[model samples]
Target: MASIVPAEKIDVIRRIEQLAVGAGLAAIVQTAIKLGIPDSFDDGSVTVDELAKSAQAEPGTLGRLMRALTVHGVFDEVEPGRYTHNDLSRYLREDAPIPIKYLVLWMGAAWTWEAWPRLTDAIRTGKAVIPDIYGKDFYSYLGAEGAAGMGDFMKAMTAITALSAAPIVDGFDLTGVGSVADIAGGQGRLLVELMERFPHVSGTLFDLETVVANADPKLLPGGALADRTTIVHGDLYDKVPVDVDLYILKNILDAPNQQSDRALLNIKESAKPGAKVVIIDALMDASVEELRVTTLVDLFLLLNVGGARHNTKEFEILFEKAGLKFLGIKPVPGTFPTQHLAEALVP
Candidate 1:
């Protein structure tokens, strides 16, 4: 193990410089995706001229950008003027699972990226930079962006859930659990998958009315558990639906002090005695470096959303604060895990 002594200024400065370079590269990729170039490239290999033409970009200018991304392995310069999509770029394609194309574009949008420049403001005032950036709370700002942008938000969250939901689905045992409620679960994608895989287990997806309306009904095909699949239109802050074991909160709970407090309280009230409450979220550990780019991800939540990554101890305290006790915390293996599955029981 190595210690980051402040007196070791060279190491610290190198790390800071790396972060800046990475952020710049991210900005370029973000701009390209938002312009729909990646989605256009999925048809097959194409030269920069072809890519730019189809993407409606200036051919000469796009040539330089493709060279830049190619140097970094996003695209491969197959020959002097031919280029092909690489592994990293493939995820930006339309059919890719958890297509990060929109997610990256959303996160790197001017509103979000602008907030990082004022990271100090959030740290000093203990206020979220989201309101500072968007002139409203993050969730409210989603509405202010108009229906199209709200649709983007829903799609972006669905993509995120597809990636983050694996930990809970893989680590937990659902042996006797017949029904589950996904609290603040938008669109019910996870619930649909749960019901499909474990036929014995049914699910109720509780989310906002707008969210339910926007959800693709294909996810809720009417059938055996389709009758069992339920959608409760309400806010998790107000009330969570009752009388179901195995409540899961997938990537929820980033807010001001009181907001987080109220959310936990609501979950506690919704649960019966001894019901399992599963929390799936990013959990920092001493070995965060073991996972690729995970440390930067911690800061991403903090600078963007005023949310800092927490360790098991922080989560345990959160559970105890809301009258719940920790059952266990487990690391999901064989995947790029951005979260830890922490299960607790309401006392």
Candidate 2:
């Protein structure tokens, strides 16, 4: 007869089993979103048959999906055969006040499903696998895929910006800053938020031609903030042509070191003495749970961009290498992944 295992040991084994099959859970959630199940109903509880009719899915299969999701707390099953949205499930709605549906979709994009399996190769080579798999870098691959691929990514970035922009602007002190430039600012959402918060501060949006072509309507000519906003299209690796009191580099510095360094040096070449640069992104130093999340993102970056999230010292080194004086970093309150604003000044 086999010796009996302790109850705690059996629980540990169960947890290991859960971790082993974690991908199934991710797939289930993505499937629900793709089926439009979240948007099919409102606050009221609906039967499985009603949900299936709205989603155009088979009632039996859709009920099974709902049962799995409800068990995971994504939605609520009020009784045997009825379900309703919970706080977590509401964010999956297409018209959520703080929309994150695109973000969820982007995370499960087709490329990601292919790339994640190659994480081991990326770790072994210390380079991105996207190039090997797609025959180009991540951005080039996105460009090649055109709107079908790039649209979800841009919208996802916008969704994330929607969540963090207000808090970042509220916490940032713009005193005496006449102008600010958002470097590689996708769609100028953050820049719009910044300009709105500090009416006295004029803003510049610098990014690629393709990206800036779709800048927030408020930043386009004849729009409300257009008079105070300037849109410039150029590559950051080549140069940053805007000279402003403050340079905002948000979520764009996670590229490999050479590119990140070059971007910073380009900014230094353009900025005047005493100009300030703030790098806003997630920090490696975080609570255990936050690290658990970011570490996965860190590897995801590795698989796509050959980048890693920087700790405080690594950030200081990046600033120093670019000939800027490192100031310090402070947490941006209300940000998920706990973004930190790392500051440096031109010497």
Candidate 3:
């Protein structure tokens, strides 16, 4: 056995302590989001006293949190004690692009806070702590909360997707694809962007009835493809548009169980025999460090909607099940290895 050096031991101890400190800081941000601190600050800068009054926290306590958060680059300490939205905190604003405020509150304060504390139970049992924490699966909880909860969850997902959007646009080619259909495309954002970029490509944004109901034409700016874009309300488990030459499914099947095959089969059945089907979802290779994040995503899907991330083999099975032939599995640059752009042909 190798003897432990005193200095090395001290270093390890310090790193463990730092991890605890990071967890504490995250807790503070959680509390702030739960207390509506971000929303309050969204309008403009406010003094600690004003924030305290709004949050119903004592002046002294609130000031301390604000200072710590400012140091962390979340909020800005604009004039010593006064505070304003920094880039990090502004992202928590409800109307801000991706609007992760409720998501922060939900995960940080709600599910994660409870789930993490009982991680030992999960470890021992090798079972999800979601039912134990929330008394139900995550999706059931959200479905019970109705549209408001769904909107928050989707916003959080969109926030995550937004981070990798630029890389996606760059990695995938849309130059010559004439008719594109975005299956289970929420709110039509990605398809709209793709259509706007490739003026020659007409598109359809397909989503659930409720989701398509909320889509607005104004979201797609360029008039060149305006007439070409249609919002189609349909169930991916049922059928996909037949005439579309290009089919894109982004982060759709990761949410539900066995629906990946269902969605793909539908797309394959209706698609032109040689139509391109692009599947963009979390794909984990056997060797990768960000595999932890991918693993967590699997749990998130299981706990939330009985869905999960697929390995390369699992994806191949789906392709076979769907009567689609694999064309390629490529990685988008500047993203995690688990994020794969799997292109298949509807055969």
Candidate 4:
């Protein structure tokens, strides 16, 4: 006879098993989106055969993929052979009120698949693995000609900006701020939203030349906000060549510490004595569920850029090191991954 394991222990074992094969779940969801399965059906339940026809997949194998997704609660299998969209699945639709399809695609992009496996090496060296694998930095690789999934990555950034821009702008008090600079703001989506919200605020959009070249048309010449918008192109690490009443660095400080420091110092060097500096990004200290999501992102940043999300203390230290006065941080409600506004002043 053999000794029996406790039920709790068995559950633990099952959880570990699930964790081990997590990649399969990611792959299946991405496959479903790529096959056009989510968009193929409307609100009504769909049969495997109908889905196969709409998605152009083999009925038998598509059924297997559906089973995998349904088991994860992504879709509901009401009948043995019929499936319908659940709340979770509906967000994968292209026209979702709050879109997430591009974000999902970006997470499962080809480069991530290559980079994740080298996490161990990244941890050991305390550096990014992208350079070793791709022979260049993460941005360089993404911007390289003929790069796979580059379009999806850019679209994903736009999707994220769309989701959080309203809340972020609302949380910020731009009173008395006549001029603003969005440093490293991709395509200036948030900047456009800000300028539209505060008609009196003239804004500057700064980023790499490649990125600002595609700035929102409204921010470009002859567009709605063109007269009030200035597009500057250069590396933030080299210099931030703008002086404004307020500077917004949104989700761009997730590079190595040296680079993040350099960015803050550059802002400090260029800003006026009382200029406001806002660093908006996800904080490390958060609820368990939020941490569960963000910790993975933290590690992903490490693998790609050797960056980590900073806690309040770490942020204070960062500001202090760069010779800026650390004010405090406040949560920006309704943001996914939960962003916080860490503010400072050029003194």
Which predicted model would earn the best lDDT? Answer: 2
Lowest summed lDDT across 10 adjacent residues in model 3 is found at 216-225
Question: Which candidate comes out best when scored by TM-score?
Answer: 2
lDDT for each residue of candidate 1 in 294-336, tens digit (9 for 90 to 100): 5555556666556666678887877888878888887766435
For candidate 3, the C-alpha RMSD (Å) to the true structure equals: 4.7
> Tens-digit lDDT track for model 2 on 45-110?
999999889889899999999999999999999998799899999989998976688877887899
Candidate with more favorable, higher TM-score: 2 or 3: 2
Off by over 4 Å in 4: 145-148
Task: For candidate 4, give the lDDT of residue 270.
Answer: 91
Q: What CA RMSD would you report for each candidate? A: 4.7, 1.4, 4.7, 1.6
Backbone clashes for every candidate come to 0, 0, 0, 0
**What is the lDDT ranking, best to worst?**
2, 4, 1, 3
What are the models' TM-scores? 0.86, 0.96, 0.76, 0.95
Error of 4 at 341 (Å): 0.9
With a 3 Å backbone cut-off (N, CA, C), the pairs that clash in candidate 2 are: none
In candidate 3, what are the lDDT values of residues 1-347, reduced to their tens digit?
A: 56575766988888888777966876888877877888886657899999999999999989988887888788888797888888898887767866666556555535565566665665576566677766887656655666776666666656666666667767777656788888877767677667666778788888777666655454445544558887777777788765788888888867544667788877877887878888887786635577756776676555545567787777777777778888878777775334678888877
Total clashes for model 4 = 0
Clashing pairs in 3: none
